[model samples]
Target: MTLAVLLLVSSALPAQAASNRAKQRKLTDTQTLFTKAMRWGEFEQAWSVVDPKARESRGLTGLELSRYKQVEVTGYSEIGSMSEPDDIVVRVIEMRVVNRNTMAERTLRVRERWRWDEADGQWWLQDGLPDLWQGQ
Candidate 1:
């Protein structure tokens, strides 16, 4: 019985690790998308990653993202995250941005709630509006 219990515990560890790795990947993907879009001055593309549900709830239009001009992301750090089943994850992402023209830089700490869509098999940032570049 002891041997059987040990085997079960070992098996569960690998599965749990796999689950954690998957969550890490999804969070990384979110930061990657944001970094790539902002670095290239592609605000529209960045908007594409915003949660559609959030857009509707917040009454935000895609045009709102146009407010940003040239931006370069210098740092991205995941400060917090929460896991709820396989479909709900919330993360606080901290980033440093530099204006391409002014060369001025500031750090924006944003709490981004992410939800995993089973159909899409991916994650979406729930806040939609990151409140980025405020007073920067």
Candidate 2:
């Protein structure tokens, strides 16, 4: 009975590990799409990856989204990332932007928080859109 239990447990381990890898790949792909959209000033596409609840809470108006167009994303780099407890991941991204109106440039580090939603079967950006205007 002990050997049989051990065999079953050992068989399950590989499956669990593979599941984790698949989840990581999905997250990577989603992140890439979000990054690409942001880099190209496609806020609508990037907004699709954000957590629905977060979007709802923000009560974003059309003017709010139009603000993103005022700045051009010159560069975006992922500085670092850390996985926290409860299926949460935090990534630090350094973004360089130039204001279309003023031609002034600035670099800002944005913290992107992600959470795995089992019901949704995917990862969602917990942090809403980065406020490029914040502190400016």
Candidate 3:
């Protein structure tokens, strides 16, 4: 009886472990993509991570684009990550940078949010601070 119980427990362990690993990988991948997008000033690419409905509702365009450009000018340095299987957040230590024409540095902090996209089988941004899904 003890042997059978042990066997059953062992059998269930791998699946649970795999699921956790998958979730972590997804979160990491999302962070990497976001970092890359920021590094290159890919505002449209970054915006692609926003939930479709939010995109429609917010009508993010000119103002958002300008803000992203400001972020690009201030290069990002990742400070840390606060993440779970389903949600991942990154804190960036920013330094204000001159747009290829001058040289300067200023201090700032930027927080980004990420969440798993079940439908797309990937992870994506949850939009700006305060996140889209807060109460539920």
Query: lDDT of all the models against the reference?
Result: 0.73, 0.92, 0.61
Candidates in order, TM-scores: namely: 0.62, 0.96, 0.68
Comparing 2 and 3 by TM-score, which wins? 2
Question: In model 1, what is the error at residue 74, expressed in angstroms?
Answer: 3.1
**Residue 26 CA displacement from its true place in model 3, Å:** 2.2
Best by lDDT: 2
Tens digit of lDDT per residue, candidate 1, span 11-44? 9999999987886797678767865775566777
lDDT of 3 by residue, 39-67 (tens): 67786776776667667777666865664
Question: Which 10 residues in a row give candidate 2 its minimum summed lDDT?
Answer: 127-136
Q: Distance from true position, residue 102, model 3, in Å?
A: 8.2
Model 2 bad stretches (over 4 Å): none
Q: Which residue pairs clash in candidate 1? A: none
Candidate 3 residue 124 Cα shift, in angstroms, is 2.3
Candidate 3 has an lDDT of 0.61
Quote the RMSD, in angstroms, for model 3: 5.7
Highest-TM-score candidate: 2
Clashing pairs in 2: none
- Which portions of model 1 show Cα errors greater than 4 Å? 1-27, 57-63, 84-86, 100-102
Task: Kindly list the per-residue Cα lDDT of model 2 for residues 1-136, writing each as its tens digit.
Answer: 9999999999999999999998999999999999999999999989999999998998567997888989899999999999999999999999999999999999999999999998888999998888898755
Query: How badly does each model clash, as a count of residue pairs?
Result: 0, 0, 0
